[model samples]
Target chain A: MMKDEELVIEARDLTKVFLDFWGRPKVRAVNGIHLDVRRGEIFGLLGPNGSGKSTTIKMILGLLHPTSGQLSVLGQSPRAVSVKSRMGFMPEESYLYKYLTADEILNFYANLYGMTGSAKTERVNALIEQVGLSQARDRRVGEFSKGMARRIGLAQALLNDPDLILLDEPTSGLDPIACREVKDLLLALARQGKTILICSHHLADMQDICSRVAILLQGEVCATGSVQELLSTPDTLKLTLQAPSQTTLMAVLDLLERETGTRPQVDLTGRTLESVYIETVSKRKSAS
Target chain B: MSHYFGKSLTRISALAGLTVRDAARSRLLVSLGGILIIGLIGLPLLISGDNTLTRRLQVILNYTLSFAVTMLSIVTLWTACGGVSSEIQDRRLYLVLTKPVHRYELWLGKWLGIVALNALLLTLTGFIIGIMIWHTLFTSPESETGKRQACEQFLLARQSRLPESPISEKQAQASAAALVKSGRAPAGIDAAQVATELMKELKNARFVIAPTGTVHFTTLITTPLSGINDGLLNYKIESSRPERSPIPALWEIQAAGKKAIHLSVTNYPGLPNRLLIPGAVMKNAPSLTLSYHRLDSSSSATLFMAQNGQEPELLIPSGSWAMNLGRGLLMILCRLAFLSALGLTAGCLLSTPVAVFAAFFIMVLLAMSGYVESVATSGAFYIPHEGHELSKTWLDKVILSQFKGLNRLTQPLLRLDPVPLLEEGRRISWLLTTQAVAWLVGLYTAVTALIGMILFNRRELG
Candidate 1:
């Protein structure tokens, strides 16, 4: 039983070099690295631009092969069907067929997953509703707002009910409401035991949704851990006071330094611009 | 791959249906088709009566069909290119590639849709011609004549039996029969081309028409020659009317009571005046259709099997009795089959219009340049020297063999040309529709498969 069960993906010493005309290495897009993603988890891969994140993703997808290494998905070659059948990918940019309507695009993807006839139509309708695009299901994808396009991309990604979902910058260009919706959808999917690997630079966003995170920098992972484990510093606590004066702040700072052997910073301000904006909008919405 | 294939195919099929609906809604296809229809409607107006108009219309329609088919080929080839390049350039391919679709499926599905578009265009255009043809042949006042006209064009043919043997009496008779049957002679070869084309074309010789009209009352005999220097036989004729005699040799002709037309000879075949009739007057019931074509051998234009200098299909065939539909069908078959191969091959590699244009140029170069270059560079064993016959006739066999290889390449282009193929295809009878179709399909299969492999290999998704 153990022998029959295999790792979903395995990349050993995976490295890639972008070459110029003379066959000399122009840049090392991916340095030597190794990784294996489990069958199911909301695994978060966080990185800034040019951190080899997209490169790694492309290599895993077999769009770009590793320069020197053995890389396989679902215990077969990267090009093999076993992995492709189980896989769904969302790129940093979602370039859908402009001529196709939202419903058509969803239907097309569903068909690629071998869903057809009434089943295809039903699944497509459900996806449209789930993505909050039922209202504009017939709208041409070209006319959709960026958020809507992202939602459609998300819907297509989920069409196959793929065993492994790769979502890159899923909520990169969305309004807060849309962002929250996408996050919730991902969470809901994760709850259903689907393996999802999300790549994004939004640390706070990943922190909220990811059970585990790997932070990459300069073509390498600098840190990897759960949000609480990596972020919670020990022996650090301070009281929030309304309109604390400098003298009170100084006294508290001194007390905190003496007790905790560390100087503590004070902040009298509690609400950020976003908080005020949200509250004002909520109030206006309620009034209307 | 197959699942993705089926899915992608289904999507494209739907896309094709949507395209048809959208295209209809936009009135794009309808407008173009309307223009095509209107243009055909005016074609008959430009000609004089039923028979005349049918002949004119037949030429125009055949030519129009050919041109349209070629254009459609270009369109399909171009669309294939446009689909891929546009997707990548617009960054739209990311949409499908990201899905669970294989690259091959994506390629194949798109190809299917494009070909379907081609078939639509073809059917639409062909229907217009078909309607015009039916109206001209069936509903027109001279329906029987029109059908006979088309038949005559196909049956009557002119060709030389291999030229190395001097144009013999029997061969000359056969050629005369062929020429009269087709209403004209093949183009003649000048001294310059004789040496070159002689080896290349075993049967590629020019047939000449003698000047002046023929008189039924008297016998006129003359010998035609091969080489210009062999000898010249001069002759003259007394026609039934003196006015007819003063007319130019080309335009003048004598009826039954006229004297024997004077005979002349040249370096070609010989003919007896006993069978000579008024060349123009003998054309009873407009005998057949006629077409003029320029040949490499002669300075004057040679006549092809044209019915009254127009489409042979619109004239009398084999004594004006039965309609030989096989001829027209054969021509259409050659065009469709060859063009299919060309279009499909062009479609796969060149997936865009510009790329397809490049592919056409490449294909043309492959055919023409390969032919010319080989002939130009081949080892020269026989440079002509004066009076150097030396009995080295054995070289004929080897040189002819080499020439045949070159002709094989040229044969495809020739066969694709329906009019010529239907006439001369009898000589190359072994290569028929089935073989032609196989050749075409094979070309399409190989090229399309290559295209699929390339696209699939280049594609990547997680």
Candidate 2:
């Protein structure tokens, strides 16, 4: 368990009930739920559609008021202006001014963060290059492709160098290479002691980066723990070895059956389609 | 505190800048510019007016300037309605609200952006109109005297003084009561209603002079006439008869410390007349009394001076025309500022189309407030014919009360419209301009902004 001071996000009985025009309860989007995200760790909020993941994230970001709850972000109320200044949020969609260029958009956000002069320019430039949007920096976001717009959105979320970053569907429309880059970026940010809370449907990406995750079903948490603790099967034994001939494989299987009183299942470890696609694209670019 | 204010200002300015850029890059600015260009330049060319230089100038000022202001007002309301509501509808506000910006700052930033755009457009169009006015004055085919007449009558910023009525409302009411008791008025009619109608008749009776009869008017000039060589007495007369022929009349003019001057002249009916009063005669005068005497007993026509106090008035040169035009434009800009705030407030509570409709409804109601006041004051929706009793109903009373309330609320906006004054070349006094700013921008706009900010802060952007 993390100490109280080390907890970046703490919630108790967080609930959001959407109301109709007459102020009657229409939908219970988020039920009484509790969450705790510690410092320097990537926490994932996994849920299917209408399962309150987005609502929870929105409440944490102070975008929506909880019906009845105690929630604190970075040891302060989420709606506090100072707290917001110390945090960053990337919504599910880009939600940018369509007419503004990427450079202009970043500068606008930087200004909102009270940055100015040469430092603002330098940071904006570096982020543009980091997002691989240097060539498209002058183009308006309205003209950008979905993947390119997503990259710009990510860059803006990191513009303030916030201590706690909340991203919703960070890699929804990204290509495999961009997805890998984003995952790598999240790891690097965690290494630098920045807390991240992500809400996404991509379980593979969540499993790859999240130290701990909570699975929500119909506005309530169904399961939560570390990836290893939740995924490990206590009765199963797994091992990997170098490539072996068919006779060698059969000898190994027979020895396992003799030792364990059952024949062990065997399978080949294969590369993920995402990794293969990235490798192929990289190799093709190199050859060109 | 100063540092905090500085940072807040910086954020607001960035948001404001974004709004301006959005307008510039979108089709709004271009469309407005195109409309203004065509209206300002094409309108004067298309409309036909009298060949007199003064008449033509009046037409240009009245039509083209009015057109520009009307177009700008509609566009300003539309743009302001869409500016914030569209962003909210499209969910762009999600990203903005997540930042450290106070909701008030965001609301104020949008208002300032729309106001700034209006200022730019007003200034540009005003400049173009000024150039056109001057170009017409110098290049018209009229003679030099005609041009000089136009400059004096239509181009100079003059102050008008109307004669004060000698009769009071109390006197009218007492007389109305006597008539009602005497059964001369319709039964069941209120004395107050009778008094209002009686007052109009009494005032109108003062301007009508039977043949061989005389009528007098006294005008007090508050501002001293200095350096001006002449002042004008502008009047229009109509006869009870339909004859368009001229009638012979004698005018007796009296000023302080000066002898009464009398002149006999033939005045045409249904035409405007200007009588020049020398500066020497009016140099130190505090007031002037003029008496009109019908000279012909054989003529049976009863001369009726146009009432409403505007006719039979004195015009004294007060300021330069250019300065007056500038003040007029400033007043228009103040109105635009108020409209922007109103539109923003509506947008805060409604979607774009509904907001636009609500704002426009409000503007139209304000514009028609004069008629509303009349109807409310009369306590009837339609004018009752003479000798007709005004029947009362509870619903009528309730509706009239509502109309009165609306009129009271909107009276300040209509009290000092600059367009008519500009058309008549009357001075839009600095005091009037200051009051406009205070009432429209400071009072109305600030109130609307406060309501809008409160709503915006409480609104959920999720």
Candidate 3:
């Protein structure tokens, strides 16, 4: 929304070929991929397993070298240290040091950003609270549940207050509440003009947050556009309102048939399960 | 510049602290510590040698310290290898690497952390052994003979300087020539062999002094000695002819203008004799002169001072033992640093098991470097058939070349060993300690770390 949009990530024909011991190609994980993510946009990369979504994300994060072609993050090469300093990445799994406590992990990452003293302490504490891991701060990450570990992983990803964030399957293993919290966090980050690139298979989560998406299949982009433009059907329309009487419904169908030469499909509108669950939980919390 | 340096230091320190904390919480540290405690303290108690207390103590120092260093090396290697490879394998390294930290800092931090743990453990074990040595040598009740043995042998670090041999090279050459002319030489005798034989003959040569005769050594030492208040000489002697009993011999030792030490001994022909003289007598002495008189008119008295490496004189103490031990431990820390670099580098490029195995193989190769060097240098890889030499196979050439290259690589590290010096109670000089740091820790570790960093930078963390 805060756009005089500046490009944060630009790729042209990026490719990555994983090689075996003798330099024979084992898999072309990503091939001829092109991408552009701009500031203040939540961009999603959706794909099934082995579809090169993670590989592309890794290339953007500078964790993997592109086999060929040009790719840049923040107008610099993907391997540029300065570019990486302004970027944050959370891999698909909660890849965290098991022997470290949550507080320690956050502190460790904060220091990696050259922060120290009370500045570091405050930032670490803020992140731990932001990720809802304050109560588990002192517990070793090895002892944490999957959800707890994911929370800490998220906390570490934000330690540097990076301008660009890459989150791979960020909602995996998270509960619905936490999942909603993560979506809200991503939107909050985007509102601050922070560019986010998320790679996930959760279409609903992607729909709720991402403004634009690129769907990958077999290391190639099958579709890429704004979620609205891609999901909307120009030939169809839906009405969500209070259930109308038979007379009103018949009048609407007659008008549509006379104008379009066809009757529109009609069905009773129902609230999505996520919304109902959230509403019931909200109500229960207010009552409590 | 200072601000950037401070920030980098802070980051590196944080990573190192995390590494140390991780290792500290693991069961491996506790187990290694337990083993070290048992081995250092229990091994001394378990030994049942018939040797005297001093001999047993020397043996204990030699065995236990060597064992402790070997064990510490294994532990250090395992920690370094597993710490890096496991992080990478579990994808934990991705989190850290994604931060603003430089890749070199991560590897260096891990190495520093592992070395810090090694330092603490080694220092603790060293202190315990030191206390044990102190108790055995001084604190425990001992008889006069036992105390003398400890002082004259194990506890004191004596400096031995050889006095000039009375027999000349010309005389030794004449003797070797006479033996060869008498057809005593074997075929294909080289000049170097002849020289060696001549040196041996000189070492066995002895001089006899009749009544009122004197012998003088014109050039004994070129510099003044320290940490010594007196000189002790162990002499082996013989008589010209056998006697029914011991014969009375009178001797006087004089140096510079100082008063001579006079001694009257009932001399036995085949016995070890000790002579103690004031060190101050040797101060500013242009030469040392001795006079011997056969008090009883039986035969001439003979003195034999030749041995393999041992000399006639010993300077009782040259330096403090505590400083020596400190230097020894410093050398050990340098070696551990080298090993930490090795393990970390291997782990950077391989999986945990493979890295560990590779590091172990390297360690074994380094340990057997002397043997590898002999094989490589002696051209044992070459094949000889039908009384003619043939070139080595390509495979043999490759393996030998690899071993030779490794020898050149690890020789500096292996040469920094301090165990033998510690066991012998010889001072490991500060110069040697500095060399160990420069070559083993600074140079070798830096080169290895550079290679590892390059590989790690290009690595794809998939």
Candidate 4:
């Protein structure tokens, strides 16, 4: 485990209970879940629907207070204004002011961080370009397509160049190419020693970028470890090679069965569908 | 500390700017602006006044200015209510709350935004009305006297000074006691109520002058009327007999140690008349006593003066019409500021429709506060029939108490109304404007804003 100083987010028995109007507890959205997100790591929170992923993220962002437990972000209370200054959050939906242009939205958030002058402009401009929204920066967000709005949301999240970023379903409505781009961006941010916490249902994307992951079930963490430690199969072995003739493949299978006294499963390696779709689109765009 | 405050100000200003931009781009404001322009131009053309230019100008000013203020007030309340509630309903507030901005800052920013929008719209309306008044006054084919009368009576900012009451409360109370002892007072009403009613009747009786009898009135001018060329004494007389034609009267006016100036004049009942006092007679004279003597001894008709204390006013030109109009607009702005704060507080506590409804309900309640006060003061829940009485229940008492509280809370809002003053060409004084700011904006608005900020901060935005 990393030392406490290097921990960006630390939680002990963190819990949140939603209450009805009369103050009776209605739902235990997050129950006694512990988390430690260290510096310079991509941490994934994996869960099904209603598994408390969004609830946990909201608590961490100080949008909702925890019913009981202890939580600290960057060695300060989650609600500390100074701490929020160093953190960025992207909610499940875009949730942007529909009347404001993409550029105006970014500028508004930048101002909240007390940024001004050329530095703010440069940072906003760069984030717009990075999120692939430069073409639509002047258009109102209400007029944008879902994918375009998602891109602008991401740009706003990066406006202040926050040290710790929390994203809930970051690529929820993106196309395959944009999804890949987002994953690539997460990896790049992780390499730059920035801590990132992502809550998502996209397991393939999570597997591609997350160094460590915690799986939640019914507001409880059921499993947590490094990706390799949690997913590896010690007794299973497989080999990948270039395509062989039918006769050669049969001979190899017979030899392996005779030696091990067991029949082995055979499968061919293939590229993910996401990769295939992205490649096709990229090729078409370049040709055009 | 200053740096920190400066940063906070920047954040708040940015939020306010965004709010204004949002409203500017919305269809609601655009539609309202179009409607306002149409009303300003069309309402005057639709309502043709009497052929006199002064009456025409008065009609235009009264209707157009009132329409503008009413429309703007409604818009202000609607926009402020929706600005916060809809953002929360749509989850757009999530993005803002998660930032470094405090919730109070957000609330204040929205309020300031609404107030600024109202200011802009009100300025536009005032400018258009001003142009119309100027054009009508300067270019119309009306006679010079007609135009001059319009300027003096309906355009200049004049302060009114009323005559002191001739009867005193002590004397009225003593007379009421004597009447009660003699069994001449009404039996059902309380003694205090009887004394109050008797005071009003006795004061009215003091204004009646019998045949050949003289009545005197003293007026004290607090401010020195050095530069003013003339002042006007406006009076309206009522008679016991409505059919009586022109009654001759003599007026004697005397100043401290100066020769009495006497004039013979004819008075018509139920008609308003003004006598101009020359600057020379008013120069350096702080006090004047006027004696009215009835010259018609053959007729038994008695002249009656109104007891409302509005008549027999001495009008002194205080300031220009433009300045008065500006002050009137400022008063309206103060009212809008209070409404903005009220709507914001409601929005913080309730949903959009509920907030809007609650705000409007409060406004309606304020409009009917006079009635509420009367009912509360009456101390009865239901009106009793003739010769019937109903005892009070606990619920009735509770409701009456609530109404009393509401009256007390809303009294400040209804204290200074600018529309009537502006229509009548009376001065909306700087002192009155300051009091409005104190009560409407300073006290009422600040209280609502504090409540809103507290609720908003405690609320969970997720």
Provide chain B TM-scores across all predictions.
0.48, 0.85, 0.72, 0.84
Per-residue CA lDDT of model 2 for B1-462, tens digit only, reads: 988998899898888887778888997888888889888878887774655676778778889888988898999899889988998899888788788888898888888899888998998888888888898888899889777767777777888888766678889889999999899999789899999988888778888889999999888988777735467788888898898887888888888778998877788888888876655667768988889998879888888898765469888788888999899999999999999999988888899999999999998998897888787777658444478676655677788889899888878877868888898778899999999999989998999999999987787756
* Single-chain TM-score of chain A, each candidate: 0.84, 0.94, 0.94, 0.93
**Candidate achieving higher lDDT, 2 or 4:** 2
Q: Whole-model lDDT, candidate 3? A: 0.78
User: Which regions of candidate 4 are displaced past 4 Å?
Assistant: A1-5, A244-248, A258-262, A280-288, B165-205, B211-214, B226-284, B291-303, B309-311, B378-382, B385-391
Residues A156-237 of candidate 1 have per-residue lDDT tens digits of 8888777778889999888776787788888888777677888998877888798777776777667777677777778654
Cα RMSD of all models vs. native, in order, equals: 11.4, 4.2, 6.1, 4.1
Per-residue CA lDDT of candidate 1, range B1-462, in tens? Answer: 886557656755654554444345446567656755665555454543445643654454445555554555444444445555555565566555545556655555555555555556656665665566656566555566545545333223211121123344455556555554564544563433443334333222222222321211111222221211111112222222223212222212222343323322221112111111223332332121121122223223222111111211111112111122243344344444334334444443434566667656644643464464445345334566578853436675577566656556556544444434332212222244445545544564446456655755653332
Candidate 3 interface RMSD (Å): 1.3
In model 2, the runs with Cα more than 4 Å from the true position are: A1-5, A258-262, A283-288, B164-206, B227-230, B238-286, B295-297, B382-389
Top candidate, metric TM-score: 2
| Model 1 / residue A285 / CA error / Å | 7.0
Model 3 C-alpha lDDT per residue in residues B59-97, reported as the tens digit of each score: 667778888899999988888888789998888887787
Return the DockQ of model 3: 0.71
Better of 3 and 4 by TM-score: 4
- Per-residue lDDT value at B298 in model 1: 23
Who is ahead in DockQ, 1 or 2?
Answer: 2
Mark the 10 consecutive residues where model 3 chain B has the least summed lDDT: B210-219
Say which prediction, candidate 2 or candidate 3, comes out ahead on DockQ: 2
